[model samples]
Target: MIRVLVVDDDPLVCAHLEAVFGFADDIEVVGEAYDGAAALESVLRHRPDVVLLDLRMPGIDGLAAIPRIRAVDPPPAIVALTTFDSDHHIVRALHAGASGFLLKTTPPRELIALVRVAADGHTVLSPTVSRRLIETAADRHVTRGETLARLAALTPRETDIVACLGGGMSNARIAARIHLSEGTVKNHISQILAKLHCTNRTQAGLLAQRAGLRPPRPAG
Candidate 1:
């Protein structure tokens, strides 16, 4: 079972998240906090497997809370909660040890899925805001050498796959581009994620972009 701690200053948001978790048999809301300071206390007491954290919490705030939470022994995975995808706090949260960044307005089902995915050490960063995080990071400059080194560990074929992922291509599109089966692409992605020690594609893509893994062919 996945034990979740919902941390947001708004009680209604906390209630809604707890209600959403109620739909899943495998997840349980173990605790709720209205601020990062309170969240930290709850986290130490509950030791939840995942934390749905609001970025703008009072006191410590989500961005400041991440590393603190991570410092706990066997820290739970953290997913930053924001009202919008492009919120600048997302990157700060991610860099601070958050496993995922999710919008508060995400569909109920998807929000539940995000919790599960984060619990399992996987993420749906393949699309949307997650993709934008990496794309923007690439356009600017983040850690490059680390990403290049990680990508270099892949075989030529896997390197091809990583490039596609970094370019924000879906598994289906990558399969079409490389003439490989989608299942094969999935396997490659799995390997890439494992090798990079990244929880999700957004992290991997940003790393790839930092490494300067550009698409091999011109886009039509």
Candidate 2:
């Protein structure tokens, strides 16, 4: 089962998320926290596979708690929660090691699927968010040359995999497009992350985007 921790200052939101996960046989709600400080504590106690974390809280907000939670041995994947897709906090959270961000208004089914994706060590960016993040990187003036240098360590195959990541393609889709097995794609992703010095796929994807990498065309 994929263990999940729901963290939000609002009790209703936490309960709602718990109920949503209840319907997914593959997912379990392991714990809940009302604030970031408690989130850190709960993460240590429950050791969840994925954490749905609210960005704003009474104390030690999600932004501050993300890096702390991620510092734990074998940290869980963290997906930030926000009311607005354009929230600046999401970008900071991503840089702080969050796997991705999800709008609070996401449908229950999509939320469940995203949690499962996070548990599987994949990113959870919606196309809108992905485009905004790429724009954010561009706004920061992360020149293509700089990103290219960072990706220089990758082999041609790894480059293609990272490009798939840039397009937010899951392992299955990437495998089909690249004519590789899902297991092989997963392995390539791992190597890609290590070579790029990225803690998660979100970072690698952003790097790929900054470098203007495009996914390989589908095979005829």
lDDT of each: 0.77, 0.86
TM-score of every prediction relative to native: 0.70, 0.88
Off by over 4 Å in 1: 125-130, 138-205, 214-220
Tens digits of per-residue lDDT for model 1, 42-159: 9999999999888886678888888888888887888888786763665666667787778777888887777887887544441347554645644344356655766787888888
Worst 10 residues of 2 by lDDT: 130-139
Candidate 1 lDDT score at position 161: 79
**Which has the greatest lDDT?**
2
Kindly give the stretch of ten consecutive residues in candidate 1 with the minimal lDDT sum.
Answer: 122-131
Candidate 2 TM-score, true structure as reference: 0.88
Clash pairs detected, candidate 1 = none
lDDT of 2 at 37: 94
State model 1's lDDT.
0.77
